[model samples]
Target chain A: MKRALRLRPKGLEKGRPETKPTNDAERRQLMTAEGEVRGELRRLRARLPQVTGALAASADGLVLASETDEAKEAEHVAALTAAALGVALRLTEATGQGGFRELLIRGESGYVATYAAGPTAVLTLLAEPRINVGRLHLEARRSGARIGELIRGALERPALVPRKPNRPPSLAGP
Target chain B: MANTETALKEATTAIEGAVGAALVDYTSGMALGTIGGGKDLDLNVAAAGNTDVVRAKVRTMELLGMQDEIEDILITLGTQYHLIRLLKGRNHSGLFLYLALDKQRANLAMARHQLKRIEADLEV
Candidate 1:
């Protein structure tokens, strides 16, 4: 199965933290256009009673958008999730595990469900204690396909317009 | 209660002293639906803990190069029994239903039999 996220060499230059998209000039761009993505994810979250929040993060730990108040911290979680995915994918491949599907982390307070949106993005759903597991999977699975399409579109070309003010290209450069 | 709700309720009621019955995503250790998880026993922890069980078994299978899927996993404790049933459906992958039962009050065989039936009729 094709994975939603890919692992690059450790030494590869990573992109800078995403600039907040604000102005119409930057908002018009596709790659950095987070409004639509965030809206869709928000809608998806609404459908899943178990999902307290949802976010789409790049495999490299860039937070695209999130519905939770802690959207900013999504970057941190994404980075660790990316690392785990890298290890899990490699292990699956080395031993001939059929395909990489989904990744999950459970904590004392809640559950984190990660579904591969494509080779570049992961859709994470955070659920409270009452969240239904079966329903979440069904819901996240649907959103994953949609999010995959959106992310894949964005990745087709790097968003040319910069969202941050007068930022040097070096920020995006490796 | 609706039809689905009725089914779930009936299933839980059939098992004497059923602590919790959840439809869990083994791939992500998320419990889809849970009934009867009290403050003392957190279903979320149970779901995540069983994830390790599923992963260990899958990894062991890989090491042995065995390609068959796991049907179910049964963990027997002194006072309770944890049953993990992998839901096998075209749309259902990396998912399972976890049921915890009081050992003294539960009939293991009956619980397993009923779970299989519930799994078959599960919508997702």
Candidate 2:
């Protein structure tokens, strides 16, 4: 994480010495912002023993931070969440329910709950079937809101630093 | 819900491995009377999601130019079978019945048969 963050500034600092230090500082800030989001996920897991995994993903299906066992599973889950969200949004609109806030899907063995983390991100949780759903919603909703704020804060903080336009066709894990 | 609530109830209790059932307005993505969702799902919300499932397939079939009436749409997940039966007749127009089942214990063919029976016996 640090290497990539540091490398961006060096690559851009061929002649632009005026903005180099501040950009480096901004990258450091971004890394810490990501760390804070991870910390929130960790704390959420501590609170809910039934929570097997937690992931934050952009609305467009990019993995922001994954607390799952496998990186590939996290990426797949994030992408699937984006696809599912599209349908859920349409369903809500068709029913005149306004925007979607959350979606909870339960398979035969377990549960996959997704909370809308603001407008641009989603927080997904994998939990055991036996978990208390009311409590899961109570806790996940709070964490989802916090992660949203933290992420949005990071994005806004680097206001001058325009986001890289070259997003990968597939996920480039953050 | 008033007339066929019993029918929806029977789907869960009578059908082996039945998880849930709902009568949906696929046109509006609204659930009529949802019951017995697998694990902890809100059957109403799942029903709405399934509306898109039905729509997407119908649209795909149209794209492929397969001109046939849809009878049943089956979605097989790792551990569950989602059986959707599109209702015929005038009163049941633009509607579909959704049945979710546990894959392990479910007799898929029998479930389909029983669901067809429920559909035939459906009042509204």
Per candidate, the number of residue pairs that clash is 7, 0
Q: Per-residue lDDT tens digits of candidate 2, residues A41-150?
A: 89999987879999987666767788899999999999899888767766766786765678999888789999877655779999997565655777788898888788
- The per-residue C-alpha lDDT of model 1 at residue A128 equals 88
lDDT, residue B86, model 1: 83
| lDDT digits (tens) for residues B73-104 of candidate 1 | 99999999989888787887877778888999
The C-alpha local distance difference test score for the whole of candidate 1 amounts to: 0.68
Candidate 1 lDDT, A107-160, residue by residue in tens: 888988888775556788788864556457666777877877775565454556
The CAPRI-style docking tier of model 2 reads incorrect
Interface RMSD of structure candidate 2 (Å):
11.4
iRMS values in order, in angstroms?
7.6, 11.4
DockQ of each: 0.08, 0.02
Estimate TM-scores for all models.
0.47, 0.46
